[model samples]
Target: MTTTFADLTTMRVGGPIGRLYVPTTIPEAVDLLQRVAATADPLLVMGGGSNLVVGDVGWDGTVIKMATSEFDIDGELLTAAAGVEWDRVVAAAVDAGLAGLEALSGIPGLVGGTPVQNVGAFGTVTSDVLHSLSVYDRQTGQVERWTPDRCGFGSHRQSVFKHSDRWVVLEVTYRLRRGGQSGPIEYAELASRLGIAPGGTAAPSDVREAVLALRRGRAMVLDPDDHDTWSVGSFFINPVLPEVPDSARGCPRYPDVKGVKLTAAWLIERAGFPRGYGTEWGDGTVALSSRHTLAVTNRGGATTSEIMKFAAHIRAGVEARFGIRLNPECDLVNCSF
Candidate 1:
């Protein structure tokens, strides 16, 4: 009766875990990490498990579950423990008449995971409002505070914390506006939904509501009863290229500091792997989310192997059709397709 990763992760598909530890305090988490680091076994520090896909072979070492959930608000400055649910932070900020976080509402995962992925939605990202963060640097066995510049924030979900185990985010501080209005709405879809022009502003509460509704419509929000939400919100990162290739003519493109960012969903659908494409592949256990082409869902009783297999098919198909390889946005644990 060992607990498996299926019980912990949103995807609900990984194999049995060897060991698990839930640290209720930052000090306790650091002590556990030190102990684990002394051993030869592998280590995984998990938050909400919303962005992970583990192999069927399972983890053979230690898994640290961040469980601390304390937060403080000093006027317009909000600081939250790494384990706090991300949506709760947004809701609290809006209730306090603070702006900046409203546009990022409804994103699943913990506060600590936000910096790791630079989580964003609507028209805002975590780095946009981040002031500083406290981290337990395992390499030095010391706690340190780092500014946004030190975090190496980049385009399309890039951050220094991603795919690295050297730092454990303990708390994050966000500087928000005192006024009740949100930042300028730069995303066209969100502006249209709010009945405003792009770059216009709205009440933080209204923006939060609109964001949550949009996420729910796409099955991006977690709902236990909905198979479509039983997956990471997006399986692939939108490829950023120097120039739009001829094969991707007419595909939606956006400007990025590095180059141009192409829509992953557009490439996926055009490659013939439309929404709900894998229903006929393997006993119907896994498929693209019916509401979103970018989400690969566990329909019911799907294995991690099945999920990876389906994802590989989509990646391969897209590459074959467009000569561009799509990379996974989710962190693959002890697994690769």
Candidate 2:
């Protein structure tokens, strides 16, 4: 039987795939890409499959599953291959007494995806410690290393690499602080949990443990037996607005470089789509995670269509209740709402 996206993605949905390639090395990945580029077949490059929502029709093209896992730690600098699991990298950093990645301990996905999404957790983001990354420019058929500025990072989870497959990330290097407390904890809940003031410091291991606990509490961490974890961690990006809307008054808001960021989960719950909202809908195969309103989960035997429908309902409800439109944080493949 042919493998399907449901078997690969964390969502456990989607349909059969046409072709798949797992490259164990950078050269092999490049060679595969070059060969695939010579054809008209569509290409989907995936890391951990944590942030993708594919249609039930499935992909009828080439799918490259990054499998290369190699990394090096030179003092405070850590360099990892694109396919290295993100959490493993964080664990390694913490073990080495590195400080920067401790707050992002339990985030899913791979090293290559960090720069693409500017992955963040309780307080720290990938860009906060990124030194540089190497990418293969599909357009030019050349490999180049780029600094943070060239990545076009934004306050929201965005970069030029996201939604565009022009640059294939090959390796990532992070500059962490050697033997020091983690960068000042910027997230209030995490700080409170650690008994530190917001913007205060904590030991790296302590921060990692706290972050893992926080993520586990919200079902953000992966657990094969838990249906609540069978979804993209956050299905919708926190909506950033120039100013807080009257309707969203008293909702949790944070200052951002672009504007004020409002919690998507807050809007989602207040819009009438509470946690476990879709459990009664359709075949009850998909629903908002009972642990968190931000995650739309696959309870069991869910299809891509069902997931999208549930998400669309949540988005529509939030938009109608608040004047803001919610966009998916996960990439939708071969489907749109």
Estimate the Cα RMSD of every predicted model relative to the unseen true structure. 1.1, 1.1
Backbone clash total, candidate 1: 0
Q: What TM-score fits each model?
A: 0.97, 0.97
Clashes of each: 0, 0
| Least well predicted 10-residue stretch by lDDT in candidate 1 | 24-33
Clash pairs (backbone) in predicted model 2: none
- Encode model 2's per-residue lDDT on 1-337: one tens digit a residue: 9999899999988888899999988889889988998899998899999998899999999999998877999988999999999999999999998889998888888998899889988767789999999998888888899999999887789899887989999999999999979888878999999999999999999999998998899998999999999998899999889999999997899888899999999999999988888878999999999999999999999989888888888888988999899999989999777
Model 1 misplacement above 4 A: none
The deviation in Å at residue 303 for candidate 2 is 0.3
TM-score between model 1 and native: 0.97
lDDT of 2 at 15: 82
